[model samples]
Target: MSEVRTIGILGGGQLGRMLSVAASRLGLRCHIYEPGANPPAAEVAHACTTASYEDEAALRAFARSVDVITYEFENIPTSALDLLEDLRPIRPGREALRVSQDRLTEKSFLRDLGLATAPFADVTDAASMTVALDGIGTPAILKTRRLGYDGKGQARLSTPADAEAARAAMNGAPAILEGFVDFSREISVIAARNADGDVACFDPGENLHDNGILRRTTVPAGIPGPMRMDAVLIASKILNALDYVGVLGVELFVTPGGLVVNEIAPRVHNSGHWTQNGCVVDQFEQHIRAVAGWPLGDGARHADVVMENLIGEDMERVPELARRPDTALHLYGKAETRAGRKMGHANIVTAKSS
Candidate 1:
């Protein structure tokens, strides 16, 4: 059993901030390691190390200071991870990072597990891009295999003629062409697993994306009973396959054919914010519990919730949002908000009405 008093989080983003708050509830301290100065997590964390991932000395100190290490984001530098893993245990493990760091690898991993995914092919250059387009055809998305999120590093090709522009958008990076899925809506399952191999999954939340960024997620997804079961089962399968410890977010396409896996996030996800108001144990606490070697918590939902993200100028509505009843406002301590920046989120519970 692990006696984790201080948890080390790799990224100091909003997720890290929430994790720190959750750890506090469990009487655990969190140390955040981030390259950026004065990151949001620093406001809540017990300790904050502001240094680049390439700095071995800083990495050594950060790893040695904490009982166990976990990360908010998957794109950590490999060298930094190697140093930290040798000094302390990193939960969710390196294999999860290895698979999720690259979209091509993630898709292949899911495919090998006999799970459904959109058809995808790798593209290295113009020649490969042409070949991939020939196979997957147009009306596909060209995305960088690594380092892409929230609508960045992605291009849409409506016809074969648009391949050149899409390829140019890649900026010479290795890319993947993915055939789109015919889905009615998207949903995500926030799943958790502890070191003991027990798994718990929250009710799948129906997701709505705007400009490729998640705008809102509503609980009691408009899917049928069996699909909900399938969503949970898929999440359990992934947690077990990776031997993952901590919360994982599994995004799926609710298609008429069945549920199709879209992607997986190793850390707590934006869609799971509804759990803050809807469940007894939210994703952040579940993550802290897993990495600290505690038993997984019950994730059953007690109320219907709709979580809406406060992006960029959305901060203007915080006052109005806070004034309403049954609304929980979670704001990240960001000094400035640029366009498309995630300022915070609001979890609004719907009251049962006659």
Candidate 2:
């Protein structure tokens, strides 16, 4: 394990909290850097630096104290990472972060690698939106270039009349219009790549969304064998392309033609949370292994599992889910439950006959 004992995480949300817990199991420690107080990760981490990303002195101190660094989310400011890169090794690296930070850049990077993504064009204003609409047509999605997630900063344009208002809503942020894909289901592959160029992928999990937030993810994806293999291969290609180290979530649209890349997340992801109880090694531990420069674990599923997100008011049902023998409940220590916020998740595992 190279005797690397401490990991520094860039975000202090639930992902970092779970990662810290996983690190502890492997005899390692975690230090979280986040701007907010009482972050979930801070509760379990060995240390925490509550400083804004713009605070260079705090960032420098955080870098000097850790052996390696990784981020829980992709929205981390590039400038902060640029400073930290000079002081410590950051897993999954800047290239992966750069690719994932912008929707247009991410799509273009995938296209350059000869991967399939929905047709898209950069739209900065009404003029570009008009041009992009001409090529991609209506019934498209216009998403902001940065800081968007869980259905935020995105609008659907079903007809030409809706295009102007959609552009106005974004307030002139750099955006992209993506031609919608007619797909049967949304699936994601959780893959991990180590420093030594070894890659391992968990089973592709089929996903369902409620109001654009991931509602449920079930393994076996109910797809044909070839289709499942295709999803795995696509995830592997993305990890290899970025020379990534850590878990990567590749969201795909399973269309009649084949799997199409929707986006990539360069950290432990929600869809793979079921691995905590369903697999020999969960995505969080795999991420800890990758960032720590250790050998990756067996990415084998031990049970048929379904992961359901506890969104907003869903947290009220914790008592009910906890009563079920087959369900494992995880509640994030968030004080407020705003609409659409991801509060926690529950994993239901069932043994499968060989």
lDDT, each prediction: 0.94, 0.93
The parts of candidate 2 lying over 4 Å away from their true place are: none
lDDT score for candidate 1 against the true structure: 0.94
Query: Which regions of candidate 1 fall more than 4 Å away from where they truly are?
Result: 351-354
What is the Cα-based lDDT of residue 249 in candidate 2?
97
Cα RMSD for predicted model 1: 1.3
**How much does candidate 1 score in TM-score?**
0.98
Report residue 234 deviation for candidate 2 (angstroms).
0.5
lDDT of 1 at 292: 97
